[model samples]
Structures are given as C-alpha cells and as structure tokens.
Target: PASTQRHVKSINKRASGQAFEVILKPLSPVSDAAHSLPSPPKRDISLDDIQKKLEAAEERRRSQEAQVLRALAEKREHERDVLMKAMEENSNFSKMAEEKLQLKMDQIKENRDAHLAAMIERLPNFHGPSTSLHPTPSFSPALTLSRADTRPWRPRGGGPHRHITPPHTIMLTTAISIISGYKHG
Candidate 1:
C-alpha cells in the first residue's frame, strides 16, 4: 500500500538579499526507506495542505480575539465595583455628619432654655425700687444703672400716638416726658 503526503516549501534568501522569482512545480514523494540523499526530498503541496494551514491560522486568530474580549469585560466589572464602594463610603460619612450636627443643636437649645429660666426667677428679688434709690455697702455695677443709662430719650412712636396707658403713679414720669415733647424737639 502507498501513502499520500502534503508539504510546504520554505523561501530561501540570497546572500546579497536580491529579489528572485520562485517557479512552483509538482514534486514526487520520496520513500522513507530509501538511502540517505544529499538534499531534502520535495513533496506535493495540494489544496488540502493549503486549506489546513489557513484553518490553523484562523483558529489562532479567533482564540486571541475571545481572550481579549474576556479581559476587557473583567476590567469594566472591577471599575464598577470600585465606584460603588466609594459612593457607599460617602453616603455613610454624610449620615454621620448630619447626626452630629443634630446632637449639637439639641445641646445648644437645652442650655439656652435652662439659662433663661434661671434669669427669670432671679429678676424680682434683684430689681426692687429701693435697690435703685440706695447704694449697697459694696459697689455692684450689675444691679445699678449708671446716670447715662437713666437719661430720657424719645420713646418708640415719637409722636401723638405713643404708648401711654393710664393715670397710674408708676407711669407719671413717663407721661410727663411724652407730653412735654409732643410738639417740639
């Protein structure tokens, strides 16, 4: 029985690197059991041999394309994960800051309310009419108004419609001052 074989020819370059025509012709197959020859035996390069080589090159090209696409998809997924993690961290920070601000505001309100209550309770005991008329054993600036602070000034309305209540003795000084300035500076 005989066997058919396919072969490819390698191009040889001249030592001078000159271009030459390659004329292709049909070649006969050599028997494997023959005596050693000085030169390599040539074999036929048929349609099947060409098709097999082209198919091998195409296969390599397709495999490389698939590998590149897979790598790109993995990179995109990693970027999305990193972005989501950063957004989550920012959201947590904002929530913590808002809670801290709310706590500070509540503390301020409570302190203000407590201070106001204490001031209201102490007002009457400290502001009697006698406190204004007589000097204490020690000079206390807080309980007494200076002569400048006691000076009279025009009330809010400045005209006929000023807030005058009644003939009460407590308001006699205020009524006289308002009437004195009704028609002049």
Candidate 2:
C-alpha cells in the first residue's frame, strides 16, 4: 500500500556525536494477503431474542420490587409486633402496680380497723364517772359571790387605761424612718 511505502525508513548512528540521515526504501512487491482475507459474516439478531431479553429484564425488575416490598412488609410487621408486645408489657405492669396498690390499701384499712378495735376495747379503762343532769347539794361545792367580783378579768399590762399603738402604725413609722435614712445617707 502507498501508506506502507511511505513508512519504510532506516536510521544509522555513529560513535561520534554526528547523526546519519534517515533513508527511505522503495516499496516492495509484496501482496496484501491480510487484507484479502474474508471478514467474519455479521450475525442478524432476531426480534424474538430482543423480546425475550426485555421480558427477562422486566421479570428481574419485578422480582427485585417484590423482594423490596416483602422486606418492607416484614419490617413493618416486626415493628408492629414489638409495639404490641411493649404495650402488653406496659399494661401488665400497670395492672400489677394497681393490684399492689390495692393490696397495700387493704392492708392499711385492716391495720386501722384493728387499731380502732383495740382502742375501743380499752375505752372502759379510762372512762370517768358521769355526773347526773341535776346538781346535788352533797356532791357540789357551795360558792357565795359578791357583786364586785362579777366583772370580766383583764390582763395586767394591757388595760383600757394603757395607750398602745396599732401594729400597722408601727410598721408604717418604721418604714418611713428607713426610707428617710436611706435618702439622707
């Protein structure tokens, strides 16, 4: 080929620093056997093959989607089961607590009732004599009071003659003093 003829070249180099010229050779009379060989025949693809491939791909996609959906469903079911179990446990715990509380209340009531019964049994030991509705001269002490002794008693330090300031007036006076001191200081 003309391209092969143009590429034919030879290079020579000497021990010295000088470089020889590149010499191109003439084209040889060689036959193009490699190019003359027959090429492989092109195989035709049928429409059925493409359709089968598309159906296979579609089936794979459907299978993958189904798997994902199944996994999601399983996860949801597991979560629901866990939630139900937790709720059941919580309810059971509450019921247990309520039962315990009721038991404690019953115990308290029983103890209280027992204590009341014991107190009632001991009541007669501390009971005093009950006096009759009418006063008897033999059982009562006689007293003779003059008219001057009938007046109500009064405290010695605080009487009608003593002058005392009201508590609110004292507090007000103290507050005024404190405010005046603060302003002067």
Best candidate per TM-score, number? 2
Q: Model 1, 1-185: lDDT tens per residue?
A: 12344444556778999756555444445543365567877888999999999999999999999999999999999999999999999999999999999999999979865754454344332332233333342223323334554444434655765444333222333332332343132
Predicted candidate 2 versus true structure: per-residue lDDT over 1-185, tens digit per residue: 66456543545667886766665755454555544779899999899999999999999999999999999999999999999999999999999999999999999979865754554344322232224443233322112123443344444676585445444334434433433343354
lDDT of 2 at 42: 92
Looking at model 1, report the run of 10 residues with the lowest lDDT sum: 174-183
Off by over 4 Å in 2: 1-41, 125-185
Clashing pairs in 2: none
TM-score of each: 0.46, 0.47
C-alpha lDDT score of every prediction, in listed order: 0.58, 0.59
Off by over 4 Å in 1: 1-37, 125-185
What lDDT is reached at residue 86 by model 2?
A: 100
